[model samples]
Structures are given as structure tokens and as C-alpha cells.
Target: AQSVTQLDSHVSVSEGTPVLLRCNYSSSYSPSLFWYVQHPNKGLQLLLKYTSAATLVKGINGFEAEFKKSETSFHLTKPSAHMSDAAEYFCVVRGTSGGYQKVTFGTGTKLQVIP
Candidate 1:
């Protein structure tokens, strides 16, 4: 079974400060991990992905995540938080179940940017 855990339900950061959204995942086999961001009244957008290629993956809008198998962690980070960055983030894990592809999602973390 594959599962994802987002350590924080809500993360508040200053407009110009660094942002960190913690996530941890478990899978029976090597899995694909992803981070998605959803703005208000908008669909989820793919931020970054780790597909066993590189440990560090960069995505749109200055976001990036590092896949650490030793720690079973895939945390999202941004150097500077923008007001536009405020949104709900989801950590996802993709694996196989019953020979079919399945994806497990985290509870989601809401990011709040403070001016």
C-alpha cells in the first residue's frame, strides 16, 4: 500500500521569506511522488515530480522538492514566498495496486502568505 502524509495542515509564511511544506510518503515499491498546488476556485497544478531520476526536481514558479529515499521524505520548498503562492498544496504518491495504477493523496496543506 502507498500512503502520503503532509506534516502540516496549515503553513503561514511571510511574503518574502522562505517557504517549506513538509511531506512524507510510504510505498511497497519505488514510487513516483508529486506536489500539486491548487488556487482558489482553480484546478490543481503540477508543481514538481520525482520519478527516480534525480533527487532534486524543479517546477514552475520557483518551486522545488528533493526526493530523499533514506528519509522517505519529499518536501516542497521555495526560496521566496509570494502572495500568489498562497494556496492548497497536496503531496501525492503513485503506485500499483492489484496490477492497476493508483495514487494516494495527502490530507493537503493550506499555505497562507502574510504581508
Candidate 2:
């Protein structure tokens, strides 16, 4: 079994300030994790993913995350928050169910970028 938890339901940041969105997860086996972003009236966009490769994963829009097995966490971070970054972020974990791979999403964290 696998599950994902977004530590913060909402994050407020000033434009040009650093952004941090915490996430924790658990799985019975090696899992694939992903981060997605959704703007208002838009579809979800893939940010980055971890599939047993590098611990530090970089995504578009200057977003990055580190997969920490020791801590069971994959926290997203961006050096400078942009106004366009204000959106809903989701942490996803891939698991198996009934011989099929299924992805589970976190409750989602709403990012508010203050100009």
C-alpha cells in the first residue's frame, strides 16, 4: 500500500521569496512519486517525478524536490516564488491495487503568491 500526505493545506509566499511545500509518503515497496500543479480552470501539469533515480529532481518553472528515503518525504521547493505560481499543488504516489498500478493524490496545497 502507498499513500501521500501534503503537510500544508495552504502556503502563502511573497513574490521573489522562497517557496516550500512539504510532502510525506509511505509505501510497501519502492514507489514512484510525482508533483503536479493546477491553475484555475486548467488541467493538472506534471512538475517532477522520482522513480528510484536521482534524489534531487528538478522540474519546470524553477521548481525542485528531493526524495528523502530516510525521512519518507519529498518536499517541493523553489528559490523564488513567482506570481504565476499561485495554484493548487498535488503530491502523488503510485501504488498497486488488484494487479494494476494506481496513483493516489494528496489533499492538495493551495499556494498563494503575494506580489
Clash number for candidate 1: 0
Query: lDDT by residue for model 1 over 1-115, one digit each (tens)?
Result: 8899999999999999999999999999999999999999999999999978899999999999999999999999999999999999999999998999899999999999999
Q: Which candidate achieves the best lDDT against the true structure?
A: 1
Structural similarity to truth (TM-score) of each candidate: 0.98, 0.97
Off-target runs (Cα >4 Å) in candidate 1 are none
| Model 2 lDDT tens row, 36-80 | 999999999999999777999999999999999999999999999
The Cα local distance difference test for each model comes to: 0.96, 0.95
lDDT of 2 at 47: 98
| Candidate number achieving the greatest TM-score relative to the actual structure | 1
lDDT for model 2 comes to 0.95
